[model samples]
Target chain A: MKGMTVIVKTITSWVKILIFLFGIYIILFGHLTPGGGFAGGVILASSYILIMLAYGRDFVEENLSLPAASRIDCLGAFSFAMIAILGLVFGGSFFVNFLFQKYLPGQPLNLVSAGTIPLSNIAIGLKVGASLFLVIVSLSICCKDFRPGTSVNKKKE
Target chain B: MIIFYCLLIFMLIAAIVAVETEKLLSSVICIGAIGFGASLMFLFLRAPDIAITQIVVEVLGLIILIRATISRDLTFITGDREFFEVVVSVVIVFVIFLAGIQVLQTLPDFGSPIFAQVADAPSNTYVSRGLGKTGAANLVTSVILDFRAYDTLGEATVLFTSIIGATVILRKKCRKKMEETTG
Candidate 1:
């Protein structure tokens, strides 16, 4: 499909950054706020999806590129498991609160509190955001059979 | 109370419209309306975490559905509607709804969990000591990440698998130009 109108692209350029920042806020403040890793991650992906909608497949692929997203997804999975396994090694139990228990008994409601929760949140957030972006990219790419500079042959609804 | 019921009714009407709409895009929008309605319900119920998740998921779902519908034609005409199948499905849905209502009636209460009565339950400890143990103000986050990290790990793994499968199958370049070999 062709990139949307100039209005959409212009607005997307400005708003996408804000949305991306908000998603990061949600992810980092998961322990203190109502949003968490999953929700924040989905929000992040939607920010990219908005760009994909405003721009076209080529732009997104050029920037976010399939391979980069795949690597991030793998890194997220690896880091999350490592966090869990590290808990077992340190706290003598799987998924234990090793940081809060031993290293730092953080004060509640503080941004830097919540031992490993924030780390896990970041890991999950990266994994989800990248995967959702990957899914959308793949789906859109599969339908990009049309030639450039032409509108998709969409049937009248 | 009245607003909750209103939202529920709105969602029901939107759901019906989604099922009845002729245009796939319109149907997707109507389904999105239903999701937003539920998200509003969650907000009214004071679960901002769930409301945020629901709204984002709904947006993504709407986007994906609209993208798929615009790209491909999914209308199928199997001519001669299967009345028997429809009837059976509707009957089953109604029975399930009735059974659910009965189960809900037997439940302790809405909004408040039965942690007090069940002293040995994990929820009791979570409600009482979640902040102290996890050092997170949000008990929901503490429970999900600290107490139940295993489930979250499994969920992330599932998403990873699905996304990997999608990408592997839908490579941008296909080997269509490969020379045909007769075995």
Candidate 2:
């Protein structure tokens, strides 16, 4: 059983690495390609799911506790909302792009040419990553039988 | 015409997958793919703004649905009612396709003079003002923040609400049970 677990873990780790790299590619080329923050984030979350499935719920819970993930989700959302609010303070409308000036240095049609767009992509990437992680974690945890004393009582009483 | 045919094929495949899958999780995944394809179609039709919004909302909705379904262990379709499901899904898809083609046919072309005039005037004015005043290089930023600040505020409120909702929904029910027993 232990050996089987290790094999599964190795496979899952490779899959996670592939997904993580694919997500990076999507976000990096979001401006010029069809992929963007939303797609990239989903890909990132699938990595976490792979880890969970391969290693079991206890392993995932130990590594990425529900509380820690929830906090990250909250923080990511707050940061994104705060950035949008900053525009109001700067006398811009709402999501007023106040972050950068010139587009990033590349050809006009290059993937890296869009300046603030990439920043938006990053912000969205973080938000989606953390939130989707939390969602998956919450689902898995909720489905688990975590109630105390039930099994103990069955053994004793 | 080839592009249109390609889109039609993709849509058909998506619909078929969404209907034929026995596992609910796989069905949900297929639906999400359909949403992505629809967004791509929107972009191809020169509606980038709609495409972005569609992607955002569809992703969020899919995540929420997946979470709910998984938590409840509702991950498989049951019964010998597969035929019924397939027929119903086909009818629904056909109705939507008819409406979609009708709308597409009636809509004005992308480069129509009316759209050009509207886009040139408002977006140009906003871009110049944004550059002059806001010191931002992105035109969409100026339009969203400076020209339409109120919408941004509303968007922030929407985010806040979702955060609160998630917290409430995911709170530990066992803790409440323990508190009830102690009280």
Candidate 3:
């Protein structure tokens, strides 16, 4: 849980919020941009990772928590499945695009016209972001002694 | 084309340097550079979607790989049999390269359409029909999420399963330790 010096913490505190916001923007605007669910998810996870590195694992766990991350991951996957199943029920095929109900040529360029693409993107973004954060958190837990400034005397106290 | 070849050669050099580096950290850095170069190459290939994906995936992979190496000893002794393994690997690579060249020769001209003259060429179909069919401006998104949704579903399942595996593998020992302490 012990973190780095004041410089890293200070910089990270300011920058992490921007990274998180950027990630959300990417996820939300995925249908219109180069970055989509996976890329945005990774960026989101990186923001968390930045927080973890600058503040400490204890700080991240206290705020986000490992269990919460796992739950979010499961929820993301479930939502994606639910969306797909809904498609099957309404559109007669698995993972069909049925939400927006319009597939006109010029309609595609608009933000809200892509039936299930944006929704699916959101689902994937959530899943990827949460899972990646969990993976990093779990891996960090495996190497407790590897972190810098793990004072042996502090452990005794 | 010249730029592409230049980037490719640089990538090749980076790969070789990554392999030959004695320090694991340096090797990791070299590999990351290779990945970055590759993403740039992907961009030059006119596939912005793939380039973005490549960059993000490369960074994620680099983070994980670096974390794995962080606690491990950086230096490893080169064994006597390494030479033989290298030779065998080189031979295999050469054979693959030759086979790839042969395949390329059999195919149509480079940079030309694979299905040039066909009425139902896949590229043509996707380009012409993607937006109308899926109502997504991004043709790649439409192709992935609507046209080939099943493949995407399978990919999602794979990712979910892998994460499950990671969590289970890492959680087991901690859970057992906690149980023992409580008991």
Candidate 4:
């Protein structure tokens, strides 16, 4: 997991942050833009994955560990549920746009005016990002250890 | 248009190459080319949301596919499963077959429309009143996060469940290491 050559590493260091920011832009401006939470979240995960490719899996696991990713995954799901339930509590039924209806109803085509859309986008983005990352990381781990006809990696515990 | 035809042809060629290639890694990359071509087609059709999703998901999928294939031999998955797996899969397939028959029976007749009145369809309603109701310029966002919020919720839950399943199935080696170190 020592990563690629100096050239790839340098280029990735320069470009990963930009990709991360673009993902955030997509998620935040989803109400006015073409991309939404899922797209942005995939981009976000790929930014980290780009780093993984250039700097190796150990570097990534150090920055964002497996346990921490799982935690974020849980937190993202919990926050989305909280948002939906908040709509039910404040407004009438489930998933009502409570902000647009009751509180802080702003004009259209403006940021900070999509009511609960942006909040939901952010929650979904977090959930999707963490989920994809976890899947890739776990699959990589399994693939690395499970060589054909090699049960040596497994020890009876 | 010519562009549509070109992309369609390119994708068809790429799909053929991906299927017929001898090198597994090259095949995986060709699959990625087909995905990108589809993404471009989506863009041409004025569906940028789907285009963005397609490209990113393809990138992630390509990474996973390449990683899974990079260190494998040709003889890697040739029927090394346990007897338990064999029995379980048979049961699962039988159940799914029954469910599929029931589902096919319940499906509407061919060429039947879900909505009798096109104007009353949910998409039309979303397009007409979405801007005022949700104050979002993007109709897709408003529909996904507001009108059909439950669907998004279900999607997020599905993603969560999949990650949990992956971790549970694949982390046994790490778990064993942790236990030995703790002991």
lDDT of 1 by residue, B1-183 (tens): 899999999999999988776777788889999999999999999999999999999999988888777776554323455899999999999999999999988677766677655668888899898998889999999999998888998899899999988988776554122111210
Measured against the true structure, the TM-scores of the candidates, in listed sequence, are 0.91, 0.59, 0.88, 0.83
TM-score-sorted candidate list, best first:
1, 3, 4, 2
lDDT of 4 by residue, B92-152 (tens): 9899999999998865564454454354667667878899999999999999999999999
- Per TM-score, the best of the predicted structures is 1
Candidate 2 stretches greater than 4 Å from native: A1-8, A21-36, A90-95, A99-119, A145-157, B6-106, B110-160, B174-183
Compose the digit string of candidate 3's lDDT tens values, residues A71-139.
Answer: 989988898899899988988878878776534223656777788888888998999999999988888
i-RMS for every candidate: 4.3, 6.3, 4.1, 2.6
Instruction: List runs of model 4 lying over 4 Å from the truth.
Output: A150-157, B75-117, B172-183
Error of model 4, residue B159, in angstroms:
0.5
Per-residue CA lDDT of model 3 for B125-144, tens digit only, reads 88887776777878887787
Q: Model 3, retained fraction of real contacts?
A: 0.60
Global CA lDDT computed for model 4: 0.87
**Candidate 1 off by > 4 Å:** A146-157, B74-80, B116-119, B174-183
Candidate lDDT (C-alpha), each: 0.87, 0.63, 0.82, 0.87
How many clashes in each structure?
0, 5, 0, 0
Task: State the lDDT of candidate 2 residue by residue for A1-157, as single tens digits.
Answer: 0123777888887777887888777666655555565566666666676677677766766877867766765665666667667655662656555544332334444454533455555555666666666666655555454334453465465
CAPRI verdict on model 3? acceptable
TM-score of 2: 0.59
